[model samples]
Target chain A: MIEVRGISKRYGNLQAVDNLSITIEKGHIFGLLGPNGAGKSTTISMMCGLINPDQGQVLLNGNAPGIKETKHKIGLIPQSIALYEELTALDNLSFFADLYNLPASQKAERMEWSLAFVGLQDRAKDAVQDFSGGMKRRLNLAASLLHDPEFIFMDEPTAGVDPQSRNKLFESVFELKALGKTIIYTTHYMEEAEKLCDRVGVVDKGQLLALGTVDELIEQYGGESRVHIKSEQGEESFMTANPVNDLMTRLKGLTTVENLSLQRPNLETVFLNLTGKQLRD
Target chain B: MMKAVVALMKKDLKLLFKDKMAVFFTFIFPLLFAFFFGSIFSSSGGSQGLKIAVSDRDQTEKSQAFIGQLKEASEFRVTETDEANAKKLVRTGKQVAFIILPEGFGENYGGIFSGQPPEILVGIDPARKAEAGYLEGSLMKLGIKRFELAFSDANEMIKQLDFSIEDIQQSDDMPAEWKSLLGDYLPKFKELTELEIAKQPEGSDSSGLSFGSDGDNPMMPLKITKEEITVQKTGPRNSFSITIPQGVIWAIMGCVIGFAISLVREKTLGTLDRLAIAPISRTQILAGKALGCFAAQAMVVTLLFTIAYFMLGVRFDLIKLVLAVLAAGICFVGFMMFFASITKTEQSVAGMTNAFLIIMGMIGGAMIPLFAMPGWMQSISHISPVKWAILAFEGAIWRDFTYIEMMTPLTILTAIGVVTFFIGTRMLKLKQS
Candidate 1:
């Protein structure tokens, strides 16, 4: 568990991370969403112990962030592929393993397990310099796992990776959650946050504007459900006429229609409504 | 902590070795420089092969002997010719200095030794006064010795004449001996026509020195070969050898520029921030990077030493050489780290480091020999690490100084390394902020 209390980070006169406070429970996947310049990255940096907050403290497992003991238990996969491109996937994992002070006897086994978990077992020997963007992303994930960290901070791990690799990353995240590891995931991709997060925090201008499960967010920021109507009549007539009334009456007769939701607003709509702009700048 | 540092070091090593151009400039170029410069400067007397032209108008045994002596002297390549040919060569700049001997010099000398005074003329170009003067002076000194010998003979001949006069009187004063000496001495005495004239004045006219004609010192030749020696011989002189200091300077510069670029690249790639977030301390990250650079510099220094050894026979005391190299390597690492800390891009570092290197080389006497520089300029060279490294290398190998002699330079170099390293660490705070 982590607790951030009155956290603030100021850059000149702009508050990148305002007086923000939040609590994260163990084994839960948390998502932080915001538009550009929303201070999501700054807050993530503080959480990873890379940057210190100006006016507050972050406690992890009842200990402050950046404490050597606490840092040892956390793994960070930055937005960029921090893996050494000149080294092999295995070598990259081994490097991080050594950083965690893993004993020589267990380093190889742990590195191998991490590679397999990312489904990059066959490409472990190849240098990261030769790997594709998605492959490098997987390797980045593997690097974070070599330490078997209790808490993981992933900053848009799937930003540049293809859907196939994204799915592979999601599977790994699931596996980590099963292992009871807590995760703080930051991304601008709304669908990813919607599908993977157990709870989401929507931040804007360095402040947490909204926080809860995806369903709760959709309810709070109400948006009409998307309805697709099909009729045997000409498309122009259906478009011109009020088909919504007839469709609603007929759809109410079917069990699927009766129980159907009026597109309980996708994360993108919720994000746009909250920040008044696109998820990506 | 140790394990993490090692991992970072290994990663940095991989990066450096992968870049062939970096490896070449960082290590190979320095060695090539050392080898080239060392061999050229490592001659026995530090003579840098100078050209000299001699005009043998006398064509006499004495003049030929003098020319022979000139040829055997250190650093001279002598060519003999007539006055016209010598002048032509000098005008063409084929010769640095030219020497001229007058005709009838030997004939005059023979007469002078027999009691007649003789004169010889030598002409020299004023344009080459500095270089040509030294040779002229030595030649004149030789002529003076010969003149003294001739004078002594004349005095002895006159004394014999006095003894012969006394021999004729035979008054227990050895008068018969005096007459016999005087009878033999008068012919020789009558043979003495004039004082010997040597070395013509340096203008177009052959207005030779007239020793007997002038109311001046009789012993002084009417025309004395006046030579002046300039430019003292002290240290090595040659492009190959003189470039040692420049090479050291360039190597340090290369490191500063190279690592700064690496730092900027890592920053652009976002590797540095990522590394900072890792559990390892910042010092370890810096150490790993610096040591990696040191490893590269070591290879360069070693290559330079090997080439210099084989090409120029520049021998070094192994232990002192190693110590000097170690000190230089440390300094290079420190300098590069400092460069990396301050810059935001590799281009900036390369440009700034190159400029800094040129200034250092210029001030440190790397581009020019310190011996040729003014004292104030040489004193100013102390600010450059290259100067200190060059001093250490010269002391260890060129000067062949003992361990004690190398102590100061080595200490100074190490001190610079330590101090710069501390500054580098302090500068790294910018990254965090």
Candidate 2:
């Protein structure tokens, strides 16, 4: 578990992160969603002890993020592919494993598990330069898990990955939660947050606008679900303020109705309603 | 911490070996330079021998004999040519000097009995003053020998004249005119004929002079004998022997550039940040890089010397050579770190490291021997690491310096390495921020 308390960071004239605070519980996927320059990365950087905050502090369990004990308990997977291109995948993994001071007896077994987890066991001997973007992303994820830290911080780990690789990453995240590991993931993808994150926090301009489960967020600021109908004569739509059963009974009595569908409130609509803009904008 | 350092060093070495260009520049390029320079210097058959041209215009026995003597001397490479050609050769630097014997010179040649000896015309290159002076001294010795051969009985004549002149002055029955004329003339003659024999030239025979009270063919009172003592254990010194150490310095320089640029490359590629995120300290990363560079340079120095030992007949003290190589390697690795810290990009690091190495090489006696440099430059060369490196290596090689003598350079180099490494690491930490 991690706790960030009212942290703010400034770069010359711009306030990158403005008095931001959040709490991540154990064994859950906490997604920080925002557009470009939303201070998401700046906040994550403070939490990882990579940079200092101007106004507050971050605590990992009980100690500060930079303490030796806390540093060993967490893992950071940066947005860039930081593996050596000239070395084989296995060699690259082995190098990071050594840095963590893993035991000699456990090194080979951990490397095997890591490569398999990333679905790169067959290409373990190939140089990383020859890997595709998605493959490299998978390898980057695998490297962060080599030490099996209790907490993991990922910054846009699936930014450029393909759909299939994205699905695989989702499965891996679910599996990590199943193993009782805490993960703080940051991204601008609304659908990924809706599907993968147990709890989501919408942030923009160094401020967190909302925080709750998917259903709670949709219920509060998401407005209402609408019924849309299109016929030969004209097209009509209706907003269901109360119950969807009364609207469905009314729609069945009209034979003129051609196309009918329910447009439910989702994270994208909730973000738009909350910030008056799209999540990606 | 040490485990992390080793892991980092292993990764760096793997990347270096994977790059063919890096391996070639680090190990093979210096060997090529050594071979080229060695062949050029050795082609002249060492620095002791002088090339000269001689023209026998007199064609007399004495002139021909002098030419033959010069040809037989191991130190001279004598060539026979006309006066015009000899002068041209000397002027063009093809020969050190031109010796021309005038026609009828040997026929008119005289020793002390004659008023003057025929002069041997020597047209020497002004730039080659040392070689010209050596040749002039040789010819002077030859002239002295000719004088002894012509005036073998001159000492006996002088002794007989001393008694006769005294008897003539003391005679009582002499004529008035004869006495008056002999009296003035005898004093003048005594003053003119008073012989004070000078010391003989070295290696010259002293049996001809006879001036003793016993009158039994008086032997020469003084004998001058020349004996040459050389300090070198080997027969003679050569330029290639000294040049081998200079070549090793160049190889070390190559290592400096190779390893220094690698740090810049890693920074640009973002791998340095990745390393930072790992559970290791900044000092460990720097230590890893320094160790890697040292290993690379040490290997290169050893390889170059081993090749020189077999191909160029370069000999060294094995233990001293190993120590010198290690010291030089450490010093340059520190230089590599310092260079990497100041530069931001690979291109900048490469350009700066090259300029630094070249300037140091020129001032430190790699491009030219320190002994041959001007006094001011030699004094300033002490500040350069390359200078210390060459000194240490030469101590191991031909200089045959004792351990105490070698320690001066080794200590200075190690000190510089330590200071530079400290400064470099501090700068690297600043840059990381």
Distance from true location, Cα of B268 in model 2, Å: 3.2
Model 1 lDDT vs. the true structure?
0.73
Assess the local accuracy of residue A191 in candidate 2 as a C-alpha lDDT between 0 and 100.
86
Model 1 lDDT tens row, B225-315: 6799896754443445456545765665666567767866777776777677677788887887787677766666676667656774556
Interface RMSD of each: 1.7, 1.5
Over the stretch A1-281, how does candidate 1's per-residue lDDT look in tens digits? 98889899999899899898888999999999887678888998898788889889888998876777887788888888886787788777776787778888789889889888888999988988999899999888888888788999998889888888889889888889999999999988888888889999999899998889998987777365554543343121122123456456655544432232233466777877787876776
TM-score of chain A by itself in each prediction = 0.88, 0.95
- List DockQ for all candidates: 0.49, 0.44
**TM-scores of the models, in the order given:** 0.76, 0.78
lDDT of 2 at A153: 86
